[model samples]
Target: SQTIHQWPATLVQPVGSPLSLECTVEGTSNPNLYWYRQAAGRGLQLLFYSVGIGQISSEVPQNLSASRPQDRQFILSSKKLLLSDSGFYLCAWSGSGNTIYFGEGSWLTVV
Candidate 1:
Protein backbone atom coordinates (compact mmCIF):
# COMPACT_ATOMS: atom_id res chain seq x y z
CA SER A 1 0.00 0.00 0.00
CA GLN A 2 1.16 3.55 -0.70
CA THR A 3 1.97 5.83 2.21
CA ILE A 4 3.44 9.30 2.78
CA HIS A 5 5.78 10.72 5.41
CA GLN A 6 6.16 14.34 6.49
CA TRP A 7 8.28 15.54 9.40
CA PRO A 8 8.16 18.02 12.29
CA ALA A 9 4.52 17.21 12.95
CA THR A 10 4.34 20.84 14.10
CA LEU A 11 6.58 23.82 13.45
CA VAL A 12 7.04 27.40 14.61
CA GLN A 13 8.96 29.79 12.40
CA PRO A 14 9.88 33.42 12.65
CA VAL A 15 9.02 35.91 9.98
CA GLY A 16 11.49 36.14 7.06
CA SER A 17 12.97 32.74 7.78
CA PRO A 18 13.26 29.97 5.28
CA LEU A 19 10.99 26.94 5.27
CA SER A 20 11.34 23.46 3.86
CA LEU A 21 8.88 20.61 4.19
CA GLU A 22 9.38 17.19 2.72
CA CYS A 23 7.00 14.45 1.61
CA THR A 24 7.67 11.02 0.14
CA VAL A 25 5.58 8.03 -0.81
CA GLU A 26 6.21 4.30 -0.69
CA GLY A 27 4.62 1.32 -2.45
CA THR A 28 3.71 3.16 -5.59
CA SER A 29 5.39 4.62 -8.64
CA ASN A 30 4.55 7.51 -10.91
CA PRO A 31 1.71 8.54 -8.63
CA ASN A 32 0.03 11.85 -9.20
CA LEU A 33 1.65 13.91 -6.47
CA TYR A 34 0.10 17.00 -4.91
CA TRP A 35 0.66 19.60 -2.24
CA TYR A 36 -2.17 21.28 -0.37
CA ARG A 37 -2.60 23.81 2.37
CA GLN A 38 -5.53 24.01 4.75
CA ALA A 39 -6.35 27.16 6.65
CA ALA A 40 -8.16 26.59 9.94
CA GLY A 41 -11.22 24.51 9.06
CA ARG A 42 -11.27 25.35 5.40
CA GLY A 43 -11.02 22.80 2.65
CA LEU A 44 -7.73 21.77 1.03
CA GLN A 45 -6.27 24.33 -1.38
CA LEU A 46 -4.24 22.86 -4.18
CA LEU A 47 -0.79 24.36 -4.32
CA PHE A 48 1.15 22.11 -6.68
CA TYR A 49 1.04 18.85 -8.58
CA SER A 50 3.58 16.74 -10.41
CA VAL A 51 3.03 14.30 -13.21
CA GLY A 52 6.64 13.13 -13.06
CA ILE A 53 10.07 14.06 -11.85
CA GLY A 54 11.01 17.71 -12.35
CA GLN A 55 7.47 18.33 -13.57
CA ILE A 56 5.26 20.55 -11.46
CA SER A 57 2.11 22.64 -11.86
CA SER A 58 1.36 25.51 -9.51
CA GLU A 59 -2.21 26.35 -8.71
CA VAL A 60 -1.39 29.47 -6.71
CA PRO A 61 1.33 32.05 -6.72
CA GLN A 62 2.36 33.24 -3.32
CA ASN A 63 5.25 32.99 -0.86
CA LEU A 64 5.60 29.33 -1.67
CA SER A 65 7.10 26.99 -4.22
CA ALA A 66 7.31 23.24 -4.83
CA SER A 67 9.73 20.80 -6.40
CA ARG A 68 9.76 17.18 -7.40
CA PRO A 69 13.33 16.00 -7.55
CA GLN A 70 12.60 12.31 -7.81
CA ASP A 71 9.55 10.32 -8.80
CA ARG A 72 8.31 9.86 -5.22
CA GLN A 73 9.98 12.74 -3.45
CA PHE A 74 8.22 16.10 -3.29
CA ILE A 75 9.47 19.17 -1.52
CA LEU A 76 7.90 22.50 -0.57
CA SER A 77 10.22 25.38 0.04
CA SER A 78 10.21 29.09 0.75
CA LYS A 79 13.13 31.41 1.16
CA LYS A 80 11.30 33.87 3.41
CA LEU A 81 8.35 32.81 5.45
CA LEU A 82 5.50 35.20 6.11
CA LEU A 83 3.02 35.18 8.96
CA SER A 84 0.36 34.49 6.36
CA ASP A 85 2.36 31.48 5.23
CA SER A 86 1.50 29.56 8.34
CA GLY A 87 -0.96 26.74 7.82
CA PHE A 88 -1.35 22.99 7.58
CA TYR A 89 0.80 21.45 4.86
CA LEU A 90 -0.34 18.25 3.30
CA CYS A 91 1.02 15.87 0.66
CA ALA A 92 -1.09 13.45 -1.26
CA TRP A 93 -0.79 10.78 -3.93
CA SER A 94 -3.19 9.11 -6.31
CA GLY A 95 -3.14 7.04 -9.43
CA SER A 96 -5.52 9.52 -10.96
CA GLY A 97 -7.52 12.53 -9.84
CA ASN A 98 -10.44 10.21 -9.18
CA THR A 99 -9.33 9.67 -5.56
CA ILE A 100 -6.36 10.50 -3.37
CA TYR A 101 -4.75 9.66 -0.06
CA PHE A 102 -2.69 12.01 2.06
CA GLY A 103 0.12 12.16 4.52
CA GLU A 104 -0.34 12.82 8.22
CA GLY A 105 0.51 16.50 7.47
CA SER A 106 2.65 19.15 9.12
CA TRP A 107 1.28 22.07 11.11
CA LEU A 108 3.27 25.27 10.62
CA THR A 109 2.93 28.46 12.63
CA VAL A 110 4.75 31.66 11.76
CA VAL A 111 5.01 34.32 14.36
Candidate 2:
Protein backbone atom coordinates (compact mmCIF):
# COMPACT_ATOMS: atom_id res chain seq x y z
CA SER A 1 0.00 0.00 0.00
CA GLN A 2 1.81 3.12 1.20
CA THR A 3 -0.94 4.99 -0.59
CA ILE A 4 -2.93 8.07 0.27
CA HIS A 5 -6.64 8.48 -0.21
CA GLN A 6 -8.73 11.65 -0.19
CA TRP A 7 -12.41 12.27 -0.71
CA PRO A 8 -14.64 14.75 -2.53
CA ALA A 9 -12.09 15.07 -5.30
CA THR A 10 -13.83 18.20 -6.47
CA LEU A 11 -16.18 20.69 -4.90
CA VAL A 12 -18.11 23.88 -5.61
CA GLN A 13 -19.56 25.79 -2.67
CA PRO A 14 -21.13 29.11 -1.98
CA VAL A 15 -19.36 31.59 0.21
CA GLY A 16 -19.83 30.91 3.94
CA SER A 17 -20.46 27.23 3.36
CA PRO A 18 -18.78 24.53 5.40
CA LEU A 19 -16.14 22.15 4.11
CA SER A 20 -14.52 18.88 5.09
CA LEU A 21 -11.63 16.94 3.57
CA GLU A 22 -10.55 13.52 4.62
CA CYS A 23 -7.41 11.52 3.97
CA THR A 24 -5.90 8.21 4.98
CA VAL A 25 -2.58 6.50 4.51
CA GLU A 26 -2.02 2.80 4.31
CA GLY A 27 0.93 0.40 4.54
CA THR A 28 2.83 2.61 6.91
CA SER A 29 3.04 3.20 10.62
CA ASN A 30 3.30 6.43 12.49
CA PRO A 31 3.76 8.35 9.29
CA ASN A 32 3.88 12.10 9.19
CA LEU A 33 0.77 13.39 7.49
CA TYR A 34 0.29 16.84 6.10
CA TRP A 35 -2.39 19.10 4.71
CA TYR A 36 -1.54 21.63 2.07
CA ARG A 37 -3.19 24.18 -0.20
CA GLN A 38 -2.24 25.47 -3.62
CA ALA A 39 -3.59 28.65 -5.09
CA ALA A 40 -4.16 29.48 -8.75
CA GLY A 41 -0.51 30.08 -9.53
CA ARG A 42 1.26 29.51 -6.30
CA GLY A 43 3.18 26.62 -4.85
CA LEU A 44 2.00 24.27 -2.16
CA GLN A 45 1.48 25.93 1.20
CA LEU A 46 1.54 23.79 4.30
CA LEU A 47 -1.58 24.18 6.37
CA PHE A 48 -1.28 21.48 8.99
CA TYR A 49 0.75 18.45 9.97
CA SER A 50 0.67 15.56 12.38
CA VAL A 51 3.53 13.50 13.72
CA GLY A 52 1.36 10.95 15.42
CA ILE A 53 -2.05 10.34 16.76
CA GLY A 54 -3.44 13.43 18.50
CA GLN A 55 -0.42 15.48 17.50
CA ILE A 56 -1.40 18.21 15.08
CA SER A 57 0.51 21.34 14.12
CA SER A 58 -0.86 24.33 12.27
CA GLU A 59 1.37 26.34 10.02
CA VAL A 60 -1.00 29.16 9.22
CA PRO A 61 -3.76 31.03 10.98
CA GLN A 62 -6.94 30.52 9.00
CA ASN A 63 -10.39 29.03 9.10
CA LEU A 64 -8.93 25.57 8.54
CA SER A 65 -8.35 22.92 11.17
CA ALA A 66 -7.02 19.38 11.15
CA SER A 67 -7.48 16.22 13.13
CA ARG A 68 -6.15 12.69 13.33
CA PRO A 69 -9.09 10.54 14.21
CA GLN A 70 -7.13 7.36 13.67
CA ASP A 71 -3.55 6.33 13.36
CA ARG A 72 -3.70 6.30 9.59
CA GLN A 73 -6.30 8.94 8.93
CA PHE A 74 -6.12 12.71 8.76
CA ILE A 75 -8.89 15.23 8.33
CA LEU A 76 -9.18 18.86 7.33
CA SER A 77 -12.23 20.88 8.12
CA SER A 78 -13.63 24.35 8.18
CA LYS A 79 -16.79 25.48 9.88
CA LYS A 80 -17.30 28.40 7.51
CA LEU A 81 -15.86 28.87 4.09
CA LEU A 82 -14.50 32.05 2.52
CA LEU A 83 -13.82 32.94 -1.08
CA SER A 84 -10.15 33.06 -0.34
CA ASP A 85 -10.31 29.54 0.99
CA SER A 86 -11.00 28.11 -2.42
CA GLY A 87 -8.01 26.25 -3.79
CA PHE A 88 -6.45 22.87 -4.44
CA TYR A 89 -6.19 20.96 -1.19
CA LEU A 90 -3.85 18.04 -0.85
CA CYS A 91 -3.14 15.34 1.71
CA ALA A 92 0.25 13.77 2.00
CA TRP A 93 2.33 11.47 4.14
CA SER A 94 6.00 10.81 4.64
CA GLY A 95 8.04 8.14 6.25
CA SER A 96 11.38 8.77 7.94
CA GLY A 97 13.10 10.48 5.07
CA ASN A 98 12.55 13.07 2.39
CA THR A 99 10.28 10.84 0.39
CA ILE A 100 6.68 11.97 0.48
CA TYR A 101 3.47 10.79 -1.14
CA PHE A 102 0.48 12.93 -2.01
CA GLY A 103 -3.13 12.13 -2.55
CA GLU A 104 -5.13 12.78 -5.71
CA GLY A 105 -6.09 16.14 -4.23
CA SER A 106 -9.37 18.02 -3.81
CA TRP A 107 -10.23 21.12 -5.78
CA LEU A 108 -12.58 23.64 -4.20
CA THR A 109 -14.19 26.55 -5.99
CA VAL A 110 -16.27 29.07 -4.08
CA VAL A 111 -18.96 30.93 -5.93
Candidate 3:
Protein backbone atom coordinates (compact mmCIF):
# COMPACT_ATOMS: atom_id res chain seq x y z
CA SER A 1 0.00 0.00 0.00
CA GLN A 2 1.41 3.38 -1.04
CA THR A 3 0.57 6.70 0.52
CA ILE A 4 1.49 10.35 0.18
CA HIS A 5 1.54 12.88 2.98
CA GLN A 6 1.59 16.66 2.63
CA TRP A 7 2.08 18.95 5.60
CA PRO A 8 0.65 22.23 6.85
CA ALA A 9 -2.98 21.72 5.80
CA THR A 10 -3.28 25.48 5.60
CA LEU A 11 -1.07 28.54 5.89
CA VAL A 12 -1.39 32.28 6.13
CA GLN A 13 1.70 34.42 5.71
CA PRO A 14 2.68 37.95 4.98
CA VAL A 15 4.29 38.95 1.74
CA GLY A 16 8.12 38.66 1.65
CA SER A 17 8.25 35.99 4.33
CA PRO A 18 9.62 32.50 3.86
CA LEU A 19 7.48 29.40 3.26
CA SER A 20 8.03 25.67 3.29
CA LEU A 21 5.70 22.81 2.29
CA GLU A 22 6.66 19.18 2.49
CA CYS A 23 5.39 15.91 0.98
CA THR A 24 6.54 12.34 1.19
CA VAL A 25 5.68 9.04 -0.47
CA GLU A 26 5.57 5.74 1.33
CA GLY A 27 5.68 2.12 0.09
CA THR A 28 6.85 3.07 -3.35
CA SER A 29 10.21 2.95 -5.14
CA ASN A 30 11.48 5.41 -7.72
CA PRO A 31 8.15 7.13 -7.91
CA ASN A 32 7.60 10.18 -10.04
CA LEU A 33 6.72 13.07 -7.76
CA TYR A 34 5.02 16.32 -8.66
CA TRP A 35 3.89 19.63 -7.21
CA TYR A 36 0.86 21.47 -8.46
CA ARG A 37 -1.19 24.54 -7.63
CA GLN A 38 -4.81 25.35 -8.26
CA ALA A 39 -6.42 28.73 -8.19
CA ALA A 40 -10.02 29.33 -7.34
CA GLY A 41 -12.25 28.17 -10.21
CA ARG A 42 -9.16 27.31 -12.28
CA GLY A 43 -7.57 24.06 -13.35
CA LEU A 44 -4.54 22.58 -11.70
CA GLN A 45 -1.17 23.95 -12.77
CA LEU A 46 1.99 21.93 -12.60
CA LEU A 47 4.71 23.58 -10.59
CA PHE A 48 7.45 20.96 -10.36
CA TYR A 49 8.17 17.30 -10.90
CA SER A 50 10.96 14.89 -9.98
CA VAL A 51 11.94 11.73 -11.80
CA GLY A 52 14.41 10.82 -9.12
CA ILE A 53 16.22 12.20 -6.14
CA GLY A 54 17.96 15.56 -6.75
CA GLN A 55 16.24 15.74 -10.10
CA ILE A 56 13.59 18.42 -10.37
CA SER A 57 11.82 20.03 -13.31
CA SER A 58 10.04 23.32 -12.94
CA GLU A 59 6.99 23.74 -15.12
CA VAL A 60 6.74 27.47 -14.59
CA PRO A 61 8.94 30.29 -13.44
CA GLN A 62 7.79 31.57 -10.08
CA ASN A 63 8.90 32.27 -6.53
CA LEU A 64 8.86 28.63 -5.56
CA SER A 65 11.38 25.76 -5.59
CA ALA A 66 11.20 22.03 -5.13
CA SER A 67 13.79 19.67 -3.71
CA ARG A 68 14.13 15.94 -3.20
CA PRO A 69 16.57 15.34 -0.36
CA GLN A 70 15.52 11.70 -0.01
CA ASP A 71 13.92 9.19 -2.32
CA ARG A 72 10.53 9.47 -0.69
CA GLN A 73 10.73 13.05 0.52
CA PHE A 74 9.90 16.17 -1.46
CA ILE A 75 10.01 19.73 -0.23
CA LEU A 76 8.67 22.95 -1.72
CA SER A 77 9.92 26.29 -0.51
CA SER A 78 9.81 29.97 -1.21
CA LYS A 79 12.35 32.52 -0.04
CA LYS A 80 9.74 35.25 -0.19
CA LEU A 81 6.00 35.09 -0.45
CA LEU A 82 3.72 37.01 -2.75
CA LEU A 83 -0.02 37.64 -2.73
CA SER A 84 -0.23 36.13 -6.19
CA ASP A 85 1.12 32.90 -4.76
CA SER A 86 -2.02 32.25 -2.80
CA GLY A 87 -3.70 29.05 -3.88
CA PHE A 88 -4.21 25.38 -3.16
CA TYR A 89 -1.01 23.32 -3.29
CA LEU A 90 -0.96 19.63 -3.99
CA CYS A 91 1.77 17.00 -3.89
CA ALA A 92 1.38 13.87 -5.99
CA TRP A 93 3.17 10.78 -7.25
CA SER A 94 2.72 8.44 -10.17
CA GLY A 95 3.78 4.87 -10.71
CA SER A 96 4.54 4.35 -14.42
CA GLY A 97 0.99 5.02 -15.49
CA ASN A 98 -1.66 7.67 -15.71
CA THR A 99 -2.85 7.00 -12.17
CA ILE A 100 -1.59 9.88 -10.07
CA TYR A 101 -2.06 9.83 -6.30
CA PHE A 102 -2.18 13.02 -4.26
CA GLY A 103 -1.86 14.09 -0.68
CA GLU A 104 -4.32 16.00 1.48
CA GLY A 105 -3.03 19.30 0.05
CA SER A 106 -2.21 22.70 1.54
CA TRP A 107 -3.84 26.07 1.17
CA LEU A 108 -1.80 29.29 1.18
CA THR A 109 -3.14 32.78 1.55
CA VAL A 110 -0.54 35.50 1.45
CA VAL A 111 -1.48 38.89 2.84
> Using Cα atoms with residue i matched to residue i, what is each candidate's TM-score against the true structure?
0.94, 0.96, 0.97
Predicted candidate 1 versus true structure: per-residue lDDT over 61-99, tens digit per residue: 899999999999999999999999999999999985558
The best candidate by lDDT is: 3
lDDT of 2 by residue, 12-100 (tens): 99988888899999899999999999998889999999999999999999998999989999999988899999999999999988698
TM-score between model 3 and native? 0.97
Please state the error at residue 61 of candidate 1 in Å: 1.1
Q: Evaluate residue 45 in candidate 3 and report its C-alpha lDDT on the 0 to 100 scale.
A: 97
lDDT of 1: 0.92
What's the lDDT for all of these models?
Answer: 0.92, 0.93, 0.96
Superior by lDDT: candidate 1 or candidate 3: 3
How well is each residue in 1-111 modelled by candidate 3, as lDDT tens digits? 999999999999999999999999999999999999999988899999999999999999999999999999999999999999999999999998769999999999999
Pick out the ten consecutive residues of candidate 2 with the lowest summed lDDT: 1-10
Best-fitting candidate, scored by TM-score: 3
Q: Candidate 2 at 33: error in angstroms?
A: 0.3
Estimate the lDDT of model 3: 0.96
